[model samples]
Target: AGYNHDADTKAGILSACGIEAGPDDAVNLNNLDDWQEFYNAEIAS
Candidate 1:
Protein backbone atom coordinates (compact mmCIF):
# COMPACT_ATOMS: atom_id res chain seq x y z
CA ALA A 1 0.00 0.00 0.00
CA GLY A 2 1.00 3.62 -0.52
CA TYR A 3 0.93 6.46 1.95
CA ASN A 4 -0.76 9.80 1.43
CA HIS A 5 -0.03 13.14 3.08
CA ASP A 6 -3.03 15.34 3.54
CA ALA A 7 -3.50 18.87 4.91
CA ASP A 8 -4.48 17.96 8.45
CA THR A 9 -1.78 15.33 8.52
CA LYS A 10 0.77 17.95 7.50
CA ALA A 11 -0.59 20.37 10.05
CA GLY A 12 -0.37 17.83 12.85
CA ILE A 13 3.15 17.03 11.84
CA LEU A 14 4.08 20.70 11.83
CA SER A 15 2.43 21.17 15.20
CA ALA A 16 4.36 18.35 16.74
CA CYS A 17 7.59 19.87 15.48
CA GLY A 18 6.87 23.27 17.05
CA ILE A 19 6.68 24.72 13.55
CA GLU A 20 3.79 26.78 12.29
CA ALA A 21 2.35 27.01 8.79
CA GLY A 22 0.99 30.20 7.33
CA PRO A 23 -2.78 30.38 6.84
CA ASP A 24 -2.33 30.96 3.12
CA ASP A 25 0.40 28.39 2.65
CA ALA A 26 0.41 24.69 1.92
CA VAL A 27 3.05 22.20 2.98
CA ASN A 28 5.68 21.49 0.32
CA LEU A 29 8.80 19.44 0.98
CA ASN A 30 10.85 21.98 -0.97
CA ASN A 31 10.11 24.62 1.64
CA LEU A 32 11.98 24.80 4.95
CA ASP A 33 8.86 24.88 7.10
CA ASP A 34 7.40 21.88 5.38
CA TRP A 35 10.69 20.05 5.28
CA GLN A 36 11.36 20.57 8.96
CA GLU A 37 7.77 19.71 9.74
CA PHE A 38 8.00 16.48 7.82
CA TYR A 39 11.38 15.59 9.24
CA ASN A 40 10.48 16.31 12.85
CA ALA A 41 7.14 14.56 12.49
CA GLU A 42 8.67 11.49 10.92
CA ILE A 43 11.20 11.21 13.75
CA ALA A 44 8.66 12.06 16.42
CA SER A 45 6.24 9.40 15.24
Candidate 2:
Protein backbone atom coordinates (compact mmCIF):
# COMPACT_ATOMS: atom_id res chain seq x y z
CA ALA A 1 0.00 0.00 0.00
CA GLY A 2 1.01 3.57 -0.64
CA TYR A 3 -0.20 7.02 0.17
CA ASN A 4 -1.86 8.90 -2.63
CA HIS A 5 -1.00 12.22 -1.02
CA ASP A 6 2.03 11.95 1.20
CA ALA A 7 3.64 15.18 2.32
CA ASP A 8 7.12 14.12 1.31
CA THR A 9 5.86 13.18 -2.12
CA LYS A 10 4.18 16.53 -2.40
CA ALA A 11 7.42 18.20 -1.44
CA GLY A 12 9.24 16.24 -4.10
CA ILE A 13 6.75 17.42 -6.66
CA LEU A 14 7.50 20.98 -5.64
CA SER A 15 11.22 20.39 -6.20
CA ALA A 16 10.78 19.84 -9.91
CA CYS A 17 12.99 22.27 -11.84
CA GLY A 18 13.15 24.24 -8.58
CA ILE A 19 9.65 25.40 -9.32
CA GLU A 20 7.17 25.95 -6.55
CA ALA A 21 4.22 23.67 -6.81
CA GLY A 22 0.68 24.88 -6.88
CA PRO A 23 -2.35 22.68 -6.34
CA ASP A 24 -2.09 21.49 -9.97
CA ASP A 25 1.54 20.47 -9.74
CA ALA A 26 0.85 17.54 -7.48
CA VAL A 27 -1.55 16.13 -10.02
CA ASN A 28 1.05 15.77 -12.77
CA LEU A 29 2.21 12.15 -12.86
CA ASN A 30 3.80 12.05 -16.27
CA ASN A 31 7.46 11.84 -15.43
CA LEU A 32 8.55 8.60 -13.80
CA ASP A 33 12.06 8.95 -15.23
CA ASP A 34 12.40 12.40 -13.71
CA TRP A 35 10.80 11.24 -10.51
CA GLN A 36 13.20 8.32 -10.33
CA GLU A 37 16.09 10.71 -10.71
CA PHE A 38 14.68 12.73 -7.87
CA TYR A 39 14.25 9.57 -5.83
CA ASN A 40 17.84 8.62 -6.43
CA ALA A 41 19.09 11.95 -5.22
CA GLU A 42 16.85 11.81 -2.19
CA ILE A 43 18.12 8.35 -1.24
CA ALA A 44 21.76 9.15 -1.89
CA SER A 45 21.82 12.18 0.38
Candidate 3:
Protein backbone atom coordinates (compact mmCIF):
# COMPACT_ATOMS: atom_id res chain seq x y z
CA ALA A 1 0.00 0.00 0.00
CA GLY A 2 1.06 3.57 -0.47
CA TYR A 3 2.14 5.73 2.42
CA ASN A 4 -0.41 7.92 4.16
CA HIS A 5 2.03 10.81 4.39
CA ASP A 6 4.39 10.37 1.51
CA ALA A 7 6.87 13.16 0.86
CA ASP A 8 6.70 12.58 -2.91
CA THR A 9 2.96 12.99 -2.83
CA LYS A 10 3.30 16.18 -0.84
CA ALA A 11 5.75 17.48 -3.39
CA GLY A 12 3.35 16.63 -6.19
CA ILE A 13 0.57 18.53 -4.48
CA LEU A 14 2.78 21.57 -4.26
CA SER A 15 3.81 21.25 -7.92
CA ALA A 16 0.22 20.79 -9.00
CA CYS A 17 -0.59 24.30 -7.86
CA GLY A 18 2.66 25.70 -9.28
CA ILE A 19 3.56 27.23 -5.94
CA GLU A 20 5.49 26.42 -2.82
CA ALA A 21 3.70 24.81 0.09
CA GLY A 22 2.94 27.19 2.91
CA PRO A 23 3.26 26.40 6.59
CA ASP A 24 -0.43 25.45 6.66
CA ASP A 25 -0.24 23.42 3.48
CA ALA A 26 -0.53 19.69 4.00
CA VAL A 27 -1.51 16.64 1.96
CA ASN A 28 -3.29 13.92 3.86
CA LEU A 29 -4.25 11.54 1.12
CA ASN A 30 -4.43 8.40 3.16
CA ASN A 31 -7.05 6.42 1.28
CA LEU A 32 -9.56 6.33 -1.55
CA ASP A 33 -12.06 8.24 0.54
CA ASP A 34 -9.58 11.05 0.94
CA TRP A 35 -8.86 10.99 -2.78
CA GLN A 36 -12.54 11.18 -3.64
CA GLU A 37 -13.08 14.16 -1.39
CA PHE A 38 -10.07 15.96 -2.77
CA TYR A 39 -11.05 15.20 -6.37
CA ASN A 40 -14.59 16.41 -5.83
CA ALA A 41 -13.39 19.62 -4.30
CA GLU A 42 -10.93 20.25 -7.10
CA ILE A 43 -13.63 19.64 -9.71
CA ALA A 44 -16.04 21.91 -7.90
CA SER A 45 -13.44 24.66 -7.81
Clash totals for all models, in order?
Answer: 0, 0, 0
Best by lDDT: 1
Number of backbone clashes in candidate 1: 0
Question: Stretches of candidate 3 above 4 Å error?
Answer: 1-4, 23-45
TM-score of 3: 0.36
Residue 44 displacement in candidate 2 (angstroms): 24
Q: Give per-residue CA lDDT, model 2, range 1-45, as digits (tens).
A: 332546667666656545666343433533543665776799747
Per-residue lDDT of 30 in model 1:
27
Using TM-score as the measure, name the better of candidate 1 and candidate 2.
1
Q: Which lDDT value does model 3 have at 44?
A: 50
Cα RMSD (angstroms) for every candidate in the order listed: 7.8, 6.9, 6.6
Candidate 1's C-alpha lDDT? Answer: 0.57
Candidate 2 or 3, higher lDDT? 2
Select the stronger candidate by lDDT from 1 and 3.
1
Query: lDDT of all the models against the reference?
Result: 0.57, 0.54, 0.51
